[model samples]
Structures are given as C-alpha cells and as structure tokens.
Target: MKLDESALAATTNDLTREVDARGVADLIEFRMDQADDPLEQLAAYDGELPIIATNRARWFGGKASDTGRLDDLFSASRYDAVEFVDIELETVRAKEWLAHEFRENDVQLIISHHDFEETPDRDVLDAIIEQCAEFGDVAKVAVFPQNQGDTLTLLEAVNDATNRGIDVAGISMGEIGSHTRVIGHLYGSKLGYAPLLADDNDYAPGQIPLEKLASLIELTKNERVDGQVIDTIRSEVSVPKELTLSD
Candidate 1:
C-alpha cells in the first residue's frame, strides 16, 4: 500500500515474518545487510506489504560492509515491492548523483544519519535534517540520547524541519530515550520502525514490542496536546512541571 504521509514499518531481516506482522505494521523494512541472499528473497517475495529496503553498513552500527553496498541497494530498488530505499546521508552527499539514480527507479530515498555516541545539539540536528531533506524524499536520523532532554532536542529538530514542510523521521536509542519511539511521530517523525515480532532482536536499541507500540500509537493519538505546547516545552524552562498540575 502507498503511504500518503507517515508510516509505521515493521523492521525485519527475514521476509518470512511478513505474514505475522500484517495486523500492526504498515510496511516492511527489509534489512539486506543482516539477511542471507536478500536479493533472492526480494525476488521471491509475495507478501502484501510494501517494503522500505535497508542495507545498513557496519560503520553506521550495522553488519554490512562497504563493498558493493550501493550496487546491492540499487539492485533492490528494481524490485516491485520496494517503495522506498534507505541510504546514508554521508554516502549520498559524497556521491551526489545516487539520489537521482534511486528516484529514477520510481522509489523514494530516505537519507539517514546515526549518532551512536551522543545526540548532537539542536542546531546541528536541524542542520542534519535539512541536509538530508535537500537530497532525499525523507530525512531520517537515529541518535543515542543520554537523557530525556536529548530526546526533546531530537523531537524539536524533527518538528522544526517538518514544520518547514520537510518529510523527516527521528529516533532516540537506548533505554533513556525509548519513549521517543512512541511519541516522535507526534512531533513530525514520518517513520516508525519496530520489530515484526516482540521476540525478534531489535535492529536498533530501545525498540518497543510491535504490538505494544501499535497500542501506544493508538492511545497517544487521542491526546489534546497542541503544537504551541510542544514548542513551549522546547523553548521555556519548567514547562513539563507546569503542565503537571495536581489532580
């Protein structure tokens, strides 16, 4: 199914789990780097879900090496099931022409950035999203947040870019930042990646169980929070405490 806007994708290295992921996941993130004969699997795929193909390289906290990486992703782009393909922002910036190559295949490109160490300050984060937006159909970033404050920084950056009409997605990794997985969309993250099954190993840190995430997404959508409130939370001090009134 084609997404009009944002999507909640089930992340998997195995395509066989697609059937199990149907009810909760809106799309499949086929991890080429972690799977065996990924192209072969894609060729044989009969699943109903559209795919967001990813072949994450090792330097960016994944298993795949750099050898022939772009070639394989380009090949993945040819498959009918692939609606989107993810490539690193660094790679795209250096090669420059690769974005044109992917779009020519009729698939959107999601230019991604990963900060395994720490979340950068807000200005840098916004800059990263802007840079990704300039070349990609969507700008995606994943950062390791040391505290809740860092998650807010990421959400603000995402919201700032999104409010500018840029399609963007962001996630904060590790325990302290897991809450971002559920709420980042409310702040303008255009994609949510959770495992196909609760028991499946997470491709990234702090991923909630798929079913739980779906439920929370449902629950959170009803909140009466406004854009101005979120902007206030980001800018002014004690916003959270002030909002926390006594029942």
Candidate 2:
C-alpha cells in the first residue's frame, strides 16, 4: 500500500491471475483503463496482493477516455484492497479540484507524468516533478529516451528531487533508457512497475521481465556489498527497470 524505496508492483489488466504472482510482486497495479469491465473486475477481486488502482487516459498513452475517468478512479478508492490511486499529472493540472477529493478520502496519490517521445531536460523534468509533489503523495515520471544520455537527464532529476526530500518514482522507458529503471532505485525511487507474465505485451518500452529484474536488483545490491564496483556492473549488465514475471 505505502510505496517505499525499491517496492516493485506488477501491472496488469487481468486481476484474476494476479494471485499467480503473489510471491514476486509487492502489490498489483490494476490498469483500470485497459480493462473491459474494470469495476466489475474490481468487485470480483479477492487477490492476496494489495492494489494500486490506475485509470489512465487516452491522451496519456492509455485507452480510457475523459468521460467518467476521474469518477471511476474515485470509485476505485473505495475498494478495500486499493491503497494507492494514480492520476496523470496533466489531468490533475486541468482538474485541480480532484486533489481536494483525494485528500478528503485519505487516498494515497501517485501523480504521474509520461513522455513518449524523449526525456525532457533536467530543468523541465525537475519542474514537472516539483509540480507533481505539490499535488500528490509521490511524484512519478516516465520518459522515453533517445539514447543513454537522456537517461542521465532523468536520473539527474530523480536525484535532485529525492535530495530535496520529494518522494519520487523515475522511469526511463524504451530500450535506450531501460537501465535507468533498475538504476534509479539506487537514487531513491520509491516504486517500479512490471507485468505479471513474460511474453505479455509490455505496458512500456524496455521493460525487463519481472523475474529477471528482481534477480538483477538482488545481484547488483549483493555486488555492492561484495566489493564489486557498481560502475562496472552497471556498464556490463543490461538491467531494466520495469518488471515482468515471464515464464
């Protein structure tokens, strides 16, 4: 429920199979916008894992439309299993009033921003994260990077925000920036999202399979303790950030 540093969540449209990933996932991120009958599925959900309800909008790389999207998220907050609710940073900016409702309900908010094209500059990224911090419990940024350099820009923003005491989740989407997803955790990112099954279409580019990602995170952390230089491990190992537990 409370997203702490290094917490990994599985993102899925199908909640029925969520129990299949119980041991691996800290929580299940229900992609409400992608589901055919989201509310119905929620009513039937009795999975062991806690839920982070997200009803993403079409304008922000999801299928859900504007109509009743916010209403649905509000409804989801009432679910006993749901501990976190994700709202697009753009949506929050447009509908400032929703912040009051979330606060009144005492629902934890994950304010997210996505850049499908390219990771923004450090200044822009910092500003976006600052704005997100003001509106929600956690500031989450997902960016598409053209090259490794772009990932650094994202990491820089993450570092800056975290250093300033902001709760943040930074993800560099796509192949070029995949490493940032794993590496960002070292910089104090509070959350990482992955898919429950391998071979499933990734919600974002460069997402590492859940099983591999978890192993890599462990390997790297142990390596850090074993006196292996993290710089070397990072350069040689192609670790990704987003999770997917594939068979």
Candidate 3:
C-alpha cells in the first residue's frame, strides 16, 4: 500500500475474475462504478489481491452519475480487503470533509485527476499534483496526450511533483502516450493500471493487458539494474519541499 514504490493494478469490474490477475498484477482496481452490483460484489470478494476501490463519476469519463458516488466509495472503504480508495481531485476540492472521512477511517486515499481530452500545460499539471498532494496519500494524474510533446509534458509534470517530494501516479492515456504507462514509473509515478486481459474491457485508453504490462516492468527493471534513471531524475530535479501527509 506504500505510495513510494511502483505497483501495477489490474482494472476490472468483475471481482470473481480477479484471481486471474494474481501473478500479473500487484493489486486489483475494482471499478465499482462500472459494476452492476458493486457493493454485493465487494461483499462477496474473496480474492488474493488487495483492492483499490474506484467509484468513478460520469464527469470524469466514467459511468457513475448518481449523487451518492462518494457514499458508495466510503462504504467500500470499510471493507478490510480494500487497502486504498481513489477519489477524483474535483470531488476532494468540492467536498471539504471527504479527506477527513478517509483519514478518520485510516484508509489510504488516491486523489486523482483525469483529462480525457488532451494533456494540459506542464505548469497546469504540476498545479494539479500540488492540489492532490495537499489532500490525498497519492496524487494521481491521467491525461490524454495527442503527441509525443504532450506525453513529455505529462512526464515533466510528474518529475516536478516528485522533485517536490509528492507521492504521485502519472500517465498519459491514448496511443500517442501509451509508452508512458510502462516508463512513467521511472520518472516517479508510483502506480500503473492495465486491464486483466487484452480481450477484456479497458477502463482507460492505452492500457496494456496485465500480462504484457508485467513483462514490460520486468524487462525495464532488468535493463535499469542500477536504477540510474530514477536516481538521475532525482539528482537533476530540484526539491523545493517534501510533501507532508496530513495527521
């Protein structure tokens, strides 16, 4: 559940199929919003991987449209199997008490922001990370990049956040930025997500199958045996401050 290390999560709405991801994924991202019976699925879950519950909202490119999305998310957090909960950055900014609710329950939170259209300016993305770090355990940003330039901007933003000592998860969605999913961890993204299978539903664009993503991680880990890429990024990026988790 540590936000400082790289972890891969398989995205799925079917809790029963999570067992297939046992070796491929470090965790399971239960997309509650996408399920027909989210709470029932959670209650019946008996899987090996810890769950990261996400009741995504329609505004954030998800199917959930009800007013009680947060209510459902909080309900899921009470489950012992759920180690983390993902809340949209907008929701956190709008609801002042949500952060406290999660903290009181001792549940780890991932404050997330998603740009389904296109990647924003590097500074804008950095600001989003700053806001996310102020509220949640891990600051997660996902943007749809149109080109390599956009993808680089997303990476730079993550680097900037990491330099500031913010625990972050950054990714550039869509095919143009697909490579970022595999390499973003090197630049300080702590988490990556992919579908359980290639034929299975993808929660986001450019998400590789869990099996393929695992292979890429292994390949990269071996190639970067000295961990020089991460070390170099840390050395070059200025650390203005360390992110302090709320007590």
Query: What does each candidate score in C-alpha RMSD?
Result: 6.3, 10.1, 9.9
What RMSD value applies to candidate 3?
A: 9.9
Q: How much is 227 displaced in model 1, in angstroms?
A: 15
For model 3, the stretches where C-alpha displacement exceeds 4 angstroms are 224-247
Give all TM-scores, in the order shown. 0.88, 0.88, 0.88
Which candidate ranks first by lDDT, i.e. highest? 3
* lDDT to native, each model: 0.88, 0.86, 0.89
- Candidate 1, number of clashes: 0
The lowest-lDDT stretch of 10 consecutive residues in candidate 2 is 219-228
Residue lDDT tens for model 2, 98-183: 88887677678899999999888888999999999999999999999988888888888898898999999999999888887677
Which stretch of 10 consecutive residues in model 1 shows the poorest summed lDDT?
A: 236-245
How well does candidate 1 match the true structure in TM-score terms?
0.88
Candidate 2 residue spans exceeding 4 A from truth: 224-247
